[model samples]
Every structure is written in structure tokens, then in C-alpha cells.
Target chain A: MSPVETGRRGAAPDPSFAPEPAGAVPVIVSRDLTVGYKLHRERKRLTALRDISLSVNAGEFVVLVGPSGCGKTTFINAIAGLVQPWEGSIEVNGRPVTGPGPDRAMVFQDYALMPWRTVESNIRMPFELQKLGLSKQEIDARVRRYIDLVDLTGFEKSFPYELSGGMKQRVGIARALVSEPDILLADEPFAAIDAMTREAMQGELERFVAKTGQTVVFITHSIDEAITLGDRVVVISYRPGQIKEVVDVNLPRPRFDYDVKSLPEYSELRDHIWRLVKDEALQTAHGAK
Target chain B: MSTPDLSDGGSISEATDPNRIEDTEWTAGEAWERYGSKVVTVINLTIFFIVWELFARSGAINQLFLPTASNMFLALWDGFTTTAPPGAVISGSIRDHLLYSLTNLSIGLFIACVIGIPAGLLMGGSKYVEKILSPYVWALASLPRIALVPLFILFLGFTVKMQITIIALSAVFPIIINAWAGVKTTDESLLAAARVFGASRAELYVKVVLPFTLPFIISGIQQGIGRGLIGVVIAEIFGGSKGLGYLITRAADTFNSALLYAVLLLLVIVSLTLIQITRSLEAYVAPWRRVDKV
Candidate 1:
């Protein structure tokens, strides 16, 4: 292929990354979504998302990237059913989203673990909640397996305070995955870690997602992260966020030790998203509607 | 003056400094000066006692008005085993009064625990409920429990039931309030995490919420126990005729200064023991919270 085609590889002519399956439908669907908050008694609303319609296939990794306060997190929260959309519907596996359910698990930005519990207990929480007539041995085995998966085997007895930020996030990831939900939603899960730690965690999380074949909706401000980790990148506009563009990343599978930042395709995708985000960010900063 | 010897030899040498011994003496003196206040406290108490004993023995004050410490000790010994009389036994003996007061305190505390914990959980968990009831809690807390003795006696009819009500009412509020605050202030994200994990409401309350609130509950109980002791004593003094308060009142009426002093001492002992027990419970429940010395 020519250099021009390779550079423009991330931006397909289709201009929509809503996964088109050869056979199956998306696990999560948001149609013409608008999410917002009511400001005062006058019912003045600040729209966070506007007309965001996307489809996340059963095992696809979709990245939602934009400037801070651009409604990326709000969008994911809506998908998690933590909040209701001002307009439109979000459905998971053909079921209309109403409230939080065990079918969709969330890995929060702050690693929001129960501090009073040990790592193992945190991972076993879903089982306990479902009251799945599983025997003690079965629960223990599942907890042990996830603990191993997260490489926190020996640290199972440690509380959240005793663990480092990255370690705590690892535990949070394990806890989210232990439920084996149909979809995993992460809202800036690695934002709190240092640069080196964040990169390491991102790689680890990418590998885990790749192995599990779980549907993921990851929200982040990092453009390079979006390219490196996502099979498709969804660019969102600032306050009253609407989807600017969706670009498919046709990168090879088992994407390891690959520095997308150095690739021309990566730089091109990054610049395209930057153009859309920078204008919106400037408008928000300058108080332009 | 002869030269000081510097070595074990019999011959005198002029090298030894005689001030070294004086420096050692001064160091010892400074050490004692640093600890001098402890010694001074004992001396001051001894002097006060001597003055008191002298005044008592001289009858500068009437013997019936105030008893010497020796007489108080004798009265305490007699209250345990003997009755002062022309063959009349003391019905309100020291052992009897202690047992009566202890039973009242125990039953009251049990009732307080039964009421305080669940009430605290409800108030703490529900903001609307807490808001509606806060005024009543404030009124109860600020009310002088002693002044309510007559009301309690009137309502409950001067029985042990009246005394228990006084003690429970006095103690339960603090525990409930503290537990409620602790539960309400528990980390919100923790609860959210529990919910996402699919934990049932009951399991969330049992595992996450309760452990976090326990330290506060224990602290409230400690404070409440101290208040409860006050309640028992006040209840006895106001109307009851079976506890240490009754014992002291009767002794006071007959000009039995020695007996009155002895009963007052017993009351102090009971209060001290209860305080010590609560403190130990605090330490036992939260040993992980203790800071280690370097």
C-alpha cells in the first residue's frame, strides 16, 4: 500500500465506526443520545451529550476520546445505567437500560473499592450479591482465579490502602471482571496513575481485554491511548457532546510493544481527532455556544 | 592541704581533681530536682491529712458533723459485717446497696444497647428521618436528667422500672447519635462499589457499613456508660430506697458522718471500675488503630 493510504488508514471512507457485524448485533446501542443536568429551578439544562448514536459489538474495544468535561464520562455513565439520558435510548443486549445491573460492570476512575474489605473479598462481592447458590469452595476458587489473573495472588489479604495506585486499579479491574459481565465500562480508569505506571497498566489492561474478548467502552483524554488500545475510536464534541467522527483502527491483532505514537497512521488519526476536539475545547473555554 | 591520690599506690599524687566528685553529686541533685513534684505531692497530702486529723480529734468542729479518715475506714468495715445499734441490723448494707445499684445499671445498659444500635442505623441511613427527629434528640440530650426524676417517678410509679427507664433514656441517645453519624459518614464510593458488585442491601449493611461504624459505636457506648452511672445514682437519690444513694441519704439524716463518707467512697469505686471497663473495651475493639512508638 502507498504511504498516503497507510497514513489515512485510521480514517476509512465510511466515516462511521459503529461496528458492522458480519452476523451478530451490538451488545450495547445508544441512539441519538442526549445527556445533561438541570441547572436551577428554571430548568436550564447543560447538555453533556447530543445525538451520540453508537453500537458496541459483543467483543469490540471502542475508545471514547475527547477533552475533559466533553461528556465522555457522562456517556459511559449513561451506558452503565448510573444516569438517565435526557433523550434517546441505551440498550444492552436488546434490553432497555434503566438502572445498574450485574450484566454490565463498571471500572471507575478512582478504583472505588470497598476499603474495609480485602482484595479477595472485593472480587467475590458480585457472587455474594447475586447470592448464587455456589458453595464456599466454588466462590473461593473463582476469587482465587481472578486474583491470579490480576497478578494479585499474594496481595489478596491486603486492604486497598496498603496497595499502590496501580495495584489498586488492578484489583478494581479484577473485581469488575470477576462478574464475567457481557460488557465492561471503564471511565478514565488509569487517569490517576503516573505516566510510566499508566502506560504499563494500559498495556496490561489491553492484553486482558484482548484475552477475554469482552466488549469494552473505555473513556480517556489521551489520543495515543485511544489509537493504541481501541479497535475503533469515537471522537466526541465538547459540552452537549455529539459524535464528530468514528474511525476504525485496522491494526494487527495481539498489538503488543507497538508504539502507535511513532506511526504515521497514529499521528494522522491523532491530528484528525485533535482538530475536532481543539475547536470544541476552545469554544467551551471562550464561552461560545 | 595534702595532694589527692590519682592511683592505687600508697604515695600521694597531685593530678586528681577533687571537683569531679562534686560534679557527680550535683548531677544526682539535678535528677531528684527534675522528679521533685511527685515527692512534693505526697508531702502536701500528708500535711493536709495531719491538719484534718488534728481538727477532727480536737473537736474544733462537732464530731457528728465531719468524721476523720480513720473513723470513715472503721465505718466502712462495720457496714460490711456489723450494724450500729441496740440490736438493729442495717437493712441497707454495703453489699446490698452495691448489688441493687449494679443490677439496675446492668439492666439499663442492656436495654440501651438494644435500642441504641438499631435506632442509630435507621437515623444514620435515612437523611429525611434524621432531620425530622433531630429536634427531639436535641431536646432529650439537653434536658437535665436529674430534673426528670420526679416525672419518671410519677409516670413509672417509684419502682425499679422507673430507675431503669431513667438510666436507659440517659445513656441510649449518645450511642444512637454517634452510631448514626458514623454510618451516615461512611465512604460513599464504598457503598457504590458494593452495589455494583451485586451485594444485596442486607449484605452491604452487614459487611461494609457495620464494621466502619463499630469504633464510633464503642466510643458512644463509653460516653453513655459514664452518663448511665450518673442516672442510676440520681434515680436512687431522688426516690429509690435500695441503692448506694439511699444508703448515703440515710447516713446523712442521722448525723452518721463516718457512714456517709464510706458510702461516697464506695460510689467512687463503682464509677471508676465501670470507666476502666469501657476504656479496655475501646482498646480491644480498635487495637489496629493504635500508633506505634519509635
Candidate 2:
């Protein structure tokens, strides 16, 4: 973890370094992906995403920002193997994705923590679901570490309903991270949280993924959130979502600590992304394709 | 500076001290807010009985039709404390009849749950089962259960078996329908989260669907209890040698209105008690839903 940290931080000062480093391996590769849901009542197929292609390198944080119904979730669902592509292929670690495996974990926007289970039990669920070949002691230790990592040490015995929205999402994060998956897919995980707590949680998430060195595919509707959390912000178009642009963010490590929002380049990047998303957002507001 | 330092330390200690969170004594108003309704109910009931006693003493209504509150209470107390002699015809004790009615109800409920839970779960789990069974379930459930009481009596005679069968049939539909709805409406996001965590199909049902449906099934049983009680009385009133229904009929025929009132009061208590028990059971099994319901 420290080696990756040192390497990324050392190269941050150099503006000439490419966002994708030399010899960097791509962990998620999707090419010409088309995916949709069947409208059985209408007897037609509703395309959510069409002919999309993107590649995420190991340990890179990629944020997809788009309007509502832009199929941002569909892209990650395809990567998580929750949904199959009608056309094209999605590969993870040089293999075609088939189904959800132990190597990938997701944090849901609704903090889909089982209400009946305590925080510790929710964190322990992945171990029970898929065999990770870990001993009882090892699983216990990991669960404890994640509980502490997410600042929920005192809340292990509490159920989801007893927790505030932020605390519940912290349990969600802990549960996802406890598996030590190579990739973390988060779908608007902070969208439901209060603004103040959302910022704090965003900073905490950056610290967490920095320590674990997991490649993150995060989706957000907020431009500020995308800029604050992403190394590459991929703007997606409306309706049948396609990649509009992928912008490299050369800001320093840990933007929260750096007060990167106060910088001129940060404002410029925000404006650029806003301009790109403005039309798509208008179209969505008008309920037009 | 020294004064400021002293005050700052005091405030910080006060903020951090866990002992500061001790419970405070309730004021009169707070106590009233907590239990005012119960006090009001007790006073209201006492006044109601007093009015009833006064009205009965006035003798405006026939004693055969209306009994004094005190006389009713006396009848109830006597019926509860004493038992009928062995081998006696038409036992005068409400205790014997109450016990008989309750026993039949429990057995019928047990049978209803045994048949209803699995049938409902299967219908929810498989589309084919739901399609095949829903029509008959709806047809039977919609037809008034009282209509079937006479039919059951004709089939099995005026016996405990007929009464229990009637109760079971009356209770089973609500249980089946509730369980089916519980399974059908299991939260989509919960299912997705389970699947994303690598839960297999069987594991999804066992872990996700079952716990989520437990409270639903309990509430279903609660409704079933009410319906089963109705079935019990109907079956007994139609034709039976023992039960609260028979006692009611016997008292009415003999013009013993106090005993009739006593039986009616007992039925109300029994129904409310059973419903309350099921409610607590639901709250215990699914505490999360309890908060949401409020």
C-alpha cells in the first residue's frame, strides 16, 4: 500500500506524466458494450447503455458523472457481473466476466445493509456467502479492522435502522471493504447522506481506498463529488449512455487535505465538466431522449 | 487568564462526562403524558358501570333482557371460580366452556399454520403454483366463512372435529395470502445486495427472503386468530354440546342475561389478549418494522 502511495505521490508534481502510467495493467476493460432491460409490458427492449468502451487501471479511481437515467449504474453493474451485455464484452483481469465473484464488491447507494443483522454480522456476510479460504481468526480480525477503519467500532452491535444515514453507509463501506476485493464499485453511495457528512465520508473513502489500493468505479450525479474523488472523470451522455469525455485529474494526492477546491485549475475542470453535462441534464429534465 | 482556564476546563469536563447523562426525574405533566390514557380509561369504565347499575335499578327495561352490572360481575366471578359437577348436563361454568373453545382454537390454528405457511411460500416461490392455486384460494377466501360452517357440521356432525375444521378453513386464507405477499414484495434492493455479495439462489431464500417474511407471517397469524375465533363461535352456535357459544345459547334460552353478558365480556378479553400476544411476537421478531410502522 505504501509503495503504490509513494509512487503516485512522487509522480503527482510532474504535469507531463501520463494519467495511465507505462506498464500499468488495466483491471476492468469494456468494449462496445450494449446493455438494457426488457419492457415486458410494452413488448420492447429499452436500451440503457449503447456501444460503450472504457478501461480502468489497477488502483485508479474512476468516477462516472451523468444525468439521471444515463445508464451510469448499468456500466458498473455490467462490470460487477450483475447484468449481462446484449452486445460486446466486459473483461476483468483478462477474463470475460460471468458472475459476481469474491474478487469484486459493491457499496450500494441505499446502504443495503440487512436490517435484521448487526453491523458486525453485515460485515461478516461476504465471508459466509463466498468461501475465501480464510480461517476463523483471520475473518474475525479482518471484520474488526474494517469496523475500526470505517469509524464504526462502537456500533458493531447496532442494526441498520438504529443508525443514521452516514453511519449506515459506513457499515455498508465496511462490509464491502472487508472482503479485500480487487475492485470496489460504488453507486452514488453518498447521495443519500447529508452534505456535511457526505464531504467527510468522501475524504474517509479516499483514505480507505488509498490504504487498500483497490481500483474504484464510482458513479455520482454531483460534479464536485466526481472531481473531488476521481483520478479520471468520465462524463456520460443521457438516455443510451455513451462516454462523452474522460478528463484526467492531475490534482495532488488527497484533495481534501490539499484544499484543492480553492485552486484555479479545480474551478476550470468543474466548469468544463459542467458545460459538457449541461445539455444532457436539460434533456433529462425535459423528459426527452 | 486563570479564571478563563478554570471555566474552560469545567465546561470541557461537563461535556465529556458520561455520568452527566443520568436520567432525570419526571415532572407531574411528564408522568401524565406517559400514562394519562390508562387513568382516563379506568375512571371512564367505573362511571359507565355506575350508570349501568343505576339504570338497571330503575327497572325501565325488563330484567330478563337487561341485567345489573353488579349481577353480571357476580355471574362472571362465579362462573370462573366454580366448575360443573362430573357427568353433569349443560355445564354452568364458563371456565369449562372457555377452555374447550380455546383448545379447539389452538389446534385449528396449528393446523392452519402447518398448511398455510408452506403453501403460501410455494405459491410465492413458483409462478406455476401461484397460477394454479390462486383462483381457488380467492374463491374460498371471498365466500363468507359462516356459509361453510353448516356444511362442515353436516359432513362431520356436531363434534369437535367439525368445529376445528371450520376454524382451520376460516383461518388459513389470511395466513397464505400474507405469506405470499411477503415473499412477492421482498425488497428488490435487498435481493440485489444479496446477489452482489455472492448469495446463491437457495441462500437468497433462506437468508434474505425468510427473515424478511417472519413478521409478515406473524401478523398473518394474528388475523387468522381473529377469523378462527369467529369460526369457533359460528360452528358452536350452529350445533355443539360444549363451548362459549353453547353457553351463550343456553343462558339466552333460560333468560339468564347476567351469564350471557359475562360470556360476551370473556370473548372480548380473549380476542384482545390473543391479538396483543401476536403483536408483541411480531415486534420481537422484526424490531426494524416496528419503528417504520410508527
Candidate 3:
């Protein structure tokens, strides 16, 4: 791609990346966001992200898709306050994020659940951390609510080691949601599970958010997953990753378990994303030069 | 260290499959294996005693050198029930000496743990603390403990103080090394999870670090028990006027083979009982340690 082609990528004023026309303020607005790492051992610098700008409107499901080694995780990690941007800024609710806080709760791919804690305690952690001023009864009630919402009610007393990969991620979702954050940041939360479980988790998550209208910025390399769950799919290019394109899904809410993949609209969006991601992967391989 | 969770990362429901009965009752093959093992152990002990008795009776070995099992048992019974013989240097019953040794062992283990565990935790927690203490800990742990018995005796004399110090010194190294290693080896992933969840430094150590380090501490305690047993015997044989160790030396010095054999048997029993207690303690604190055997 030429310099002009690179510039034309997600730089499209695709209105989809704009604040919702209904006057809801964007929950997250990242401007000129660039992040890099200093390889202290090797005495070199590795740039992970280039100047990228995006706006995520309130209650919107924004999924980031990219090739392997594309800075998708880094972009979300910047929001999670796990990584510092080398340049530019990320504003969560009109304020620049300084560090990890309760405003943004992360669901990691590996389901970072404490093996020793019961599912209820793990889900109840956010309140314990922030001391949210809720009464003990209120916290207990809320914890129970989220546990039921994630269909993990019976297993509330079970440890992470006792849960399956899918069950563990469900607990992770409950934990993240119980915090009642403005933005939910998930980093490939379903990547490790088998295909069948992953499909069901995607459906369960969509159903939960359909009622709650929670804002989620999910990062993944799966184009199909991005198309299935996202209202807008943000495609990042290969490393030193820049926004390549943003595609609007325009799919129905709670679209899961059915033959959603066979729909022409779904297939078209999938094909479009598949091609973008394929091109990005090829570019990453060739760009190594 | 505890054996890590052995569940195969399968579906959580599958991992705790309720229908999967963990059978305590042995199957035909297992029952045969179990009984076969017991029979082998009993047979081996019987063979050892028969050979020992025969060896003494055959005149191949002196009776004093290889006292028959009956003579040893009679001496043990007599020692338990009566006072020491008139010619003996120490006049108390065998019970008195056994109690003396036990007291030393307990006191030694207690002092060693009191000093060693905290030192290990500090060294493991802070690089600066480790830098200050590493040289001394390493030098002490590696030095031949037996050589230091002479120094202890010289400083404290042939008293209980020296005996206890020798035993405590012998037990301290394993506790220090293992406790330090246990803390240092706190799973990085667990710590990261704690940090992301906004756990403060104190909570992180209390909730995450200590529980993870418990198994290592337990294993270290087990090792110290063995070392402490050796220390007790060495101290008694070399210097102390009382304890099972003193009796063993007295029997040897006086050429009372039956008493020597009796004391040796008791020592074996005491060592085995100490090891058994430690093994059970290990099981209590870290049930996950035996996941492989299960």
C-alpha cells in the first residue's frame, strides 16, 4: 500500500466511529495514540502502535481485529492502564486515563481468576478493591445478581480449578461486570476455548449486553468473532499497528447460535473483514523487511 | 512446593464430574497388590530377625556383639518397667532418658523455626535483606554441622544447652533455604492478577504469597526433623549425660549389647514416628501435593 492508501485506512470519517447521533457522549476517545516498548535487554526500541484515533460511543460494542503481532492487545491494554502510551492520549469519559481503575475492568484471554477463591468471591472483588460504599447486603445481592446473569449461580462456590475454560471465562465476565464499569475491556477472552464453547460464550455475552447496553471494547484476531459481536469492527494493521479500517456490522442484536454466518449480510461483512485481516497478515509478513 | 492443580483444563463441570466415584474399596487387582505388599514387609522382617538370632546362636558372632532379638526385647521391657541397673552411671529409667531427648528435639525445632522462617521470608521478600544475610546463611548451611558440635560443647559445656543448640543448628538450614525459595517462587501470574484487581502490597503478601509458600515451608520442616534427629544422637553420644543418645554410648562403652540393641530399636521407632507426624502435617496443609498419587 502507498502512503496515501495507508492514510486512507481507518482514517475514513466513517461516521460509525463518530459520537452517536442520538447525542450520547462517547465513552472512550483515543487521539493520536502511540505506544512502544523499550527492549532493555536488547538495547532497542519496539514500536507497537502508531498515531491512531478512534471514538467509542456509549453502549457501543467495538471489537478490534488484527493479524497476529498487530498491536490490538496493546491498544486495549492502553485503555486498561496496563500499558502506557509512548505518545498521544486515551480519554475515558472525557478524562485521560492515568492508571488502572474501576472505570475500566479487563477480561483477560487466560481468565486470570484466582484458583483459591470461589466464583462469588472473585466476582465480588471489585467492590472489595474500590470499597464502593455499598452496604454488605447490597454487595452480596449484586454479586448474586451477576452470578445469575452469567448462568454461574450453582457454581458460585466452585474454585477456578474446578471450572472448565468456558466456565472460567464466564466467571471472568461476571467479575468484570460486577464492577459496573463504564467500559468493559476484553482481550481475546474466548480465544483459548474450543469453537463450540466460544460460539456459545459470544452469544451469552451478547445477550447480557443486549439488556444492559454496556460499552465493550473487545480485542481479537478472529474476524468472524469481531463481525458477530461488534456493532463496529476496528481493524488494526500489522505491527507498529495503525487503524486500517472500521467496518459497521449492522447486524441484529443477540445474533447467536443460529446460522448467522450463512446470512448474506453476515457473510459479506465476514468476507470483507476476512480480506482486510488477510491483507494485514500478508503485509506484516512482508513488512518484516 | 505443592504439585500444581492437576485438572486437565477440561470443562469445569467435567473436572468435578459427580458421577465419577473415587473408590476407596480396592478392585481385585488392587487388593492383591495391597495384600502382597504387606506380606512382603512382614516376611522380610521375620527373615531379618531369624538370621540375626541364628547369627548369635551359631557362634559366628559374639553374643554381646549380636545379642539375640529375645534378649534385646527383654532388656527393652525391663528398661521400660524398672530403674536403671545398680552399676549404670545414670540411675533414671529409660522413660526419663527418652523424655529428655524428646524435650531437646522439641526445643531445638522450635528455636530453629522461630529464627529460620522469618529470616527466610525476609530474604525472599527483599533483595537488600538477602544481600545482607546471604553470605552468613550460605556459610552456615554449607559448613559441616558435626564439626560445629565441638565448638558448641566448648562454649556451652556438656549441658542440655549445648545439646539443644547443636540440634537447632542442624535443623535451621533446610527451613531457611526452602522458606526463601518458596516465597521467591510465588507464581508471577498470581501476583499479576492480584495487582490488576487493585490488591495493596500487604494484602498481596498475606493472601497470595503466604498460601503459596505453605507447602514449601512444610517440606522444609520435614527435612529439619530428620536433621534434628541426627543432631540429638550426635549431641548425646558425644557430650550429654542424659537422653537416649547417652544410653546408646553407655551401653557401647560398658559392652551391654542387650541395652544397646534396645536403645537402637527405640531410636528407630522415634525417628519413624517423627517422620509420620511430619508427613501427616504435610497432608493437612497441602492436599494438592498428593494429586499425583491420587
| Alpha carbon lDDT at A79, candidate 1 | 83
| Residue lDDT tens for model 3, A1-289 | 1111111112213222333345556778888899978899999999999987888877778899998888888888788777787888888888888777777888888887766578898898778777678999999888887776666767777777666788888888888888788788898999998897787677667656644567899988788888788888988988889998988877544456344687788888888888888888888788876
lDDT of 1: 0.76
Candidate 1 structure quality by residue, lDDT tens digits, B1-294: 232121222111112222333433457778677778789988997898788888899888888987997888787887788543444434435777778889998899889989998889888888788888878888988898888889988898879999999999889988988899889888776776677666567877887789878878988887788889889888988887678877888888878898898898887878888877876776666543443411
Query: In terms of lDDT, which candidate is stronger, 1 or 2?
Result: 2
**lDDT: which candidate is best?**
2
Docking class of 1: incorrect
Model 2 bad stretches (over 4 Å) = A1-21, B1-21, B292-294
Question: Which tens-of-lDDT digit does each residue in B1-294 have in candidate 2?
Answer: 111121111110001121335778999999998899899999999999999999998999987888999999999999989999998766558999999999999999999999999998988889999999999999999999998877887899989999999999999999999999999999888888888899999999999999888888998999999999999889889899899998999999889999999899899999999999999999888899889663
Instruction: Put down candidate 2 lDDT per residue, A131-177, tens digits, no spaces.
Output: 99999999999898777667676668888898888888888888888
> Candidate 2 chain B: minimum summed lDDT over ten consecutive residues — where?
B6-15
Model 3 lDDT tens row, B190-230: 67556666677897788778877888887888899889989
Task: Give every collision pair in model 1.
Answer: A129-B198
- From the highest lDDT down, the ranking of the candidates is 2, 3, 1
Q: Is candidate 1 or candidate 3 better by DockQ?
A: 3
**How far does residue A283 in candidate 1 sit from its true spot (Å)?**
6.2
Query: What value does the lDDT take at residue A262 in candidate 1?
Result: 68
Q: Worst lDDT window (10 residues) for model 3 chain A?
A: A1-10
Ranking by TM-score: 2, 3, 1
